[model samples]
Target: MGNPKQKWTNEEEEALRAGVAKHGAGKWKLIQKDPEFNQYLHSRSNIDLKDKWRNMAAAVQGSREKLRPPRPRPVQDVPAVPSVPLQTPTVVPAPVIHESPADHVKDESGKDLPDAKNGPRYTELIFDALKDQNAMDISSILAYIEKMSDIPVPPNFRKPLGARLRRLVQQEKLEKVESSLYRLKTNTVETNASNQKDTWPRPHPPALYTKVGESLEEAAKTAAYKVVEAENKSSVAAEAIKELEKFSKMAEETDSILQLAKDIFDRCTTHGEILLVA
Candidate 1:
């Protein structure tokens, strides 16, 4: 009857995280001993601490493949953009094809979503979203898109959206006020093929993927793994080889944290026990 078995709050979770960081995850007892942690988590048992850690770990290190970054821009399937940079795009010229209305994206209900006839471009959606707001980050944009549900998001859509945004910035359709936060350019108009420059740019982006807080070494490793992933999906050995060369040096310096994740991911993949985090 003491605390009425209150649910875990964000504060308690943060304290537990601090505890784990101070004294590795295994030493729950030590964590509980420290006032930094114990003061906030006194009611919880060591078992609860361990279990919470397990849940957090599982969530963070979900599928092994996801641990590997996808290729930048759209190189076939894997958008190859880091969660942090989510770089826009590069000028690689390719034939631009506009999607048709008849081929509108269908939802799970098998009904055509709104604005399906128009080309389902990422920039269009983002531009539309920011029309009213000042700026937004990827998470907010993603959440907004999910909530609106006007357009059906493709599977693993983040990379593609990032790639599109990068292209939009390149085309001067949008501007990045911050790394993640972006705003519509004052001069920018509704982006369409006619308004875009005639010079067709390479649709694919560079292979480099660097997270904001992560070391360059780790970023390089992510790029290499991503290249491997791209090769696996598209069977484009030549392209993968080319991209792999870009990150050749970075892949060799795997830190302890990355090494541990790799080991766990590899083991889980082998056992087919890796489930996509829901």
Candidate 2:
């Protein structure tokens, strides 16, 4: 006869869920081999794990169906009767509200399950978790978010949580300090420590100050040399100006001599004309 079928314990189910969350579904062998979950699921085979997960999923779906409210019946159109005038005015009624599918989905414990697809809320939750602590590993972050959340976090939440953290790190909104540890990008690692003081723009040593003073002295010497060079250039410019003035005087004298020679030539021509007439 076949061995008696063993019922799945809560610990085994939890371990299986954790394994599925970490390694992903369909990797039954890997999940079973995982050390973290092996203790709980050592006796369970891969086939058992797969069947158990399927059953769990089916049970959840069935419970959700049971919790779902029945659809409202459509009202058929009726012929209006002739109304008699009344002394009092008629009162209007409020519309009937129907529950959505999300509202009906609850865990076995009757707690509302958290939506893994809620990206913005998840982002806020991660930020809130890291804001209080200096740094936290992925597990701690997940635990903190779960503790603070009003709804029960799903077992597959770890997969989504890892993805969200990677996205945040990529976006530069969060910093990954180590392999699994994460913190806010803007937050310093030593923020929690009170004894540590900021030491930015550290003071220069006496030797550095002495070097700076020497540099200043060299700069002053350079400036003085430049001033001397400027004075020498000024002197050369003055000499050039004096030479120009001398050249100008020589040009004027040359012009006067040319004019005098022209006047002498004109007088000689006039005297020769006078002699030829005589």
Candidate 3:
């Protein structure tokens, strides 16, 4: 007994015709799976089927090019320009001097302008201090600013500081974790915390299974529900690990089969005689 003879359908032929017209052939495997191609021929796994469709498409395209008419070249004309006479140059008068750098040196009170770098305004000093602290909380930042400079920060300035912090948050230059607490944008500690209080809780020491069991037993005496829930979670985790191992084995087998099919398809399609048989 022999295998049944596979024939290409009219729909498959049309899909090959359109695909070649659009993409200009190649990538046969991709074309085979296309909805338009799949509607007629369903075997994407068979490379021989794709090769047949490609060969048919090539013949159709060759015939189409031969039948198409040659395009004509377009003609263009150059334009002419008129001649013009040149004009003479003229001299202009100089303007009067207005406010110069020396004129701007004094303010309305006739006092010399304060140095911007050494003598920044109260708000500038506060913001600069906040930046130096890497965006710390308002209280800590203000305290640090007072210690560093002689400038007195008014109560009203706190509102502006809050607004500046909000702007910095939007600009991604500072981050606000809680209502008042803030840290640098990069999540790195930039300053020494010698004066800072230890408000955050300490981390527990790393423990083995035996230590964990002893801890659970101790916790059960204090709270049974918490201990029971933890034990059940551990059991559920063990079951999940077993299921994951099984799924991994199945996936490996499936991948192996797919690779074998791909290798066979590659060999059969490239060789003409194998494709004829396929």
* Cα lDDT listed for each candidate: 0.48, 0.49, 0.38
lDDT of 3: 0.38
Would you list the rank order by TM-score, best first?
2, 1, 3
By lDDT: ranked, best first: 2, 1, 3
lDDT of 3 at 81: 8
Candidate 1 Cα lDDT to native: 0.48
Better of 2 and 3 by TM-score: 2
- The better candidate by lDDT, 2 or 3, is 2
Q: Write the residue-wise lDDT of candidate 1 on 1-278 in tens digits.
A: 56666677655665665554335456677767766566677888888887877665443333333656663433332212212123224321121233322232344432221111112343456766888687987666655665565554433344435545655676677788877887877774664754633232322322322222233344455555455444443433356564455334223322222422333444345566754755
Clashes (N, CA, C under 3 Å) per candidate: 10, 0, 0
TM-scores of the candidates are 0.28, 0.28, 0.21
| lDDT tens digits by residue: candidate 3, 1-278 | 45475665544544553443223344455545655455555643437655765464344333433555552422121100000011112211111222222122223331211211211233345456656775567767656655565333322234334544554454455678777766666655535432221121212111101101112222222233223323333434366665345334333333222222233344334443354422
Q: Looking at candidate 1, what is the lDDT of residue 141?
A: 68
